[model samples]
Target chain A: MATAATSDIKWWAGGRSPFNMEYGKLMMWYFLMSDAFTFGAFLISYGTIRFSQNYWPDPNHVFNAFPFAGHANLPLAFVSLMTFILIISSVTMVLAVHAGHHMDRKGVIKWMIWTIVGGIAFLSCQAWEWTHLITGHHPVLIDGVVQEIGTTVSRNPWGPDVTGMMHDGMQVTKTGPVAFGGYFFGITGFHGFHVLSGVVINIIMLIMTLNGTFDRRGHYQMIEKAGLYWHFVDLVWVFVFLCFYLI
Target chain B: MQHSSNTHSPEVTFHHAPGDSASTIKKIVRTTVILSVITLIELALGFGIYMLHKNPDPSHALILFIKGVIVILSLLKAFYIVGVFMHLGDEVKNMIMTIVVPLMLFIWFIAAFLWDGNAWRNLRNTDAGHRPAKQEQVTKPVDAKKPGGIE
Candidate 1:
């Protein structure tokens, strides 16, 4: 009694996907893949410029300052702490997703709250680092005149003097090259913006969870999507840390 | 006790309770701990090398080796995050390929651009790439007669 059309229909032509993934989740992965390219380009550019220069800033000397350390040389200590915090936050985010799958609303909320806290903490550390860098002075001697310098789009306290010139009695003092600051600010600023956006998205997800939105739907796929974004941000940081801090 | 006929309908269904087994939770904790430990080791190695070298100029091979280790550690961390945390490991093979193949192109793009950028850097300092321009001094004379009789 079955119709020929119904009996002969192909699985590929059906509404269900053979890949066993929802359309939204697959799209999220694709988007993250593209975003990874953007980060990759920025990092590759950094590597190119760094190798091209005669001297690049030593990350150890540049990032030595630590909170309340009174200028003690604890090279890369602060940034390492920041990295740990971000990694822990990534752990919490994954835990939240796991909880979501189990339909444990309370567990999801708890872990998500921890992840948001970690994001804010990381941002705060970055703000402090930037403020310290901007406000600190670097003394440079040009033409027998002592001039103080700070970070700018074209110059960085971390790099050799880019604007120094020789004269009849001119003296030159250099900190770091101009390209270092340009690339540092450009790359880190871009990453910071991503973290900010991630935080905002997490906040929205938190509010929705509180309102029982996902509970009503009897699923928490939304948490999984947000976790994907949060994890991507963390993933980018791994590369950033290697390029900017370790290398 | 007597059961109602409606309660015995074949269409009746119940939702499965949501949660993970204890072993899964343990596995998540183990992964997190491993990641943290790796990060710690990286920090120690980085700082230790810097401290031990002391000189601004260290041997090129040593520096290159250290950098290689750092990059390897970073890639490992990235792998763990993407594989387990992102649940890509659990997805079907085709779905995984759908994401991984395009990412291979991303890596190629970085490699290609970096090689080209290095070539540009070398060319930038050459005579054919750079030409100096003449300029006039624009500073005002300090000995102008009207300036308080030259102070």
Candidate 2:
């Protein structure tokens, strides 16, 4: 299938033969790949800190959902719902891109709108979680005495008792050097910023869709590109959830 | 060719416009459900582990093995989400490897660090055979005449 021709012979202009993609889009993917590695580094550090510690608290206990009045310990319920919302949004986005492929402007707009809504909902849930954490919703007693109350600081179990004797559960907390919190806030906060930005980006794309930008061009490539970015954001959250909430 | 280019230029033309395809919809839903079930199972295991044995000796081989399994299963779930839902499955083999390999290596590096750090913590906390140096100096025999003495 190597049909040699003048266009195929071009160095910079022709991408179909060698890369099967335009330089611009390919570069975006490349950047995403690298960024993914950076996020992976942060998550790995978190894992190491958790593992190195003796009695690290369970993520479910640390991140219980807050309903109307008192807080409830649903662990992954809110996050799981948020995960599905993002996934559904990704589906709609892909469909929108597909519609764009067929020059179906209305379909693109509709799906893009749905995708935007889902992104907003995700951001909203995250914002709520962050607010709750910052507000010191959960309380735990430190050691067998001092009561240290905060979102990040807790007397949650991370190690066994000093003696071989066991109580209700391992009562030690504060794993590693206690600097893990700084890393946790910085990494997860940066990732959350990306999710927030993604929501804004999708909103802008939705506006463009409504204005018939893609309709006139008869291509859905831009939508596909945005979908790629959105999916990556979701993928990062998958690891974040595991790092912050589970492992 | 120029005329055809203009017709689609500065805009994209749809060859097979996007819409809700039932097959794809079904696939996505199926994947989500499956992922959810796997996560639920993980939660169940976590709870079960917590209930059965909260303080098994930190150096127990079985406990470490179970923890390893949990971590591996979690990574597997994460991989499925990225590969299937994120379209990495459709990417070139090299590109896929490029994304996955570094991630694995970095996690391993972190795991090593955590293992050493935890061991250090355990050593520092353990008070093995330390007759308290001056235990008798600090301990005073309870006097029945004292106001707060246990009767």
lDDT (Cα, 0-100) at B149 in candidate 1:
50
Clashes of 2: 19
For all candidates, the clash counts are: 6, 19
TM-score of each candidate structure, all chains considered together: 0.82, 0.70
Model 1 in CAPRI terms: which quality? Answer: acceptable
lDDT of 1 by residue, A1-247 (tens): 1222333434356565556456677788999998998888888888877766667777887788998998688898999989989999998998898788777889999999999999999999999888777776666664467567777667665545446454334333565678887788788889999999999999999999999998887678789899999999999998899899887
DockQ of each: 0.23, 0.16
Q: What are the runs in model 1 whose C-alpha is more than 4 Å off?
A: A1-11, A160-172, B1-19, B124-151
* Residue range with the least summed lDDT across 10 consecutive positions in model 1 chain B: B1-10
TM-score, cand. 2 vs. native: 0.70
List, residue by residue over A1-247, the lDDT tens digit for candidate 2. Answer: 1222323354334333233343455566777878887887676666656555555655555565765536555665676677677767777776676566566778888888888888888878877876676564222334554233345432222322345433344333333234444655667788878878877877888788888777666555677778778878877876676566555
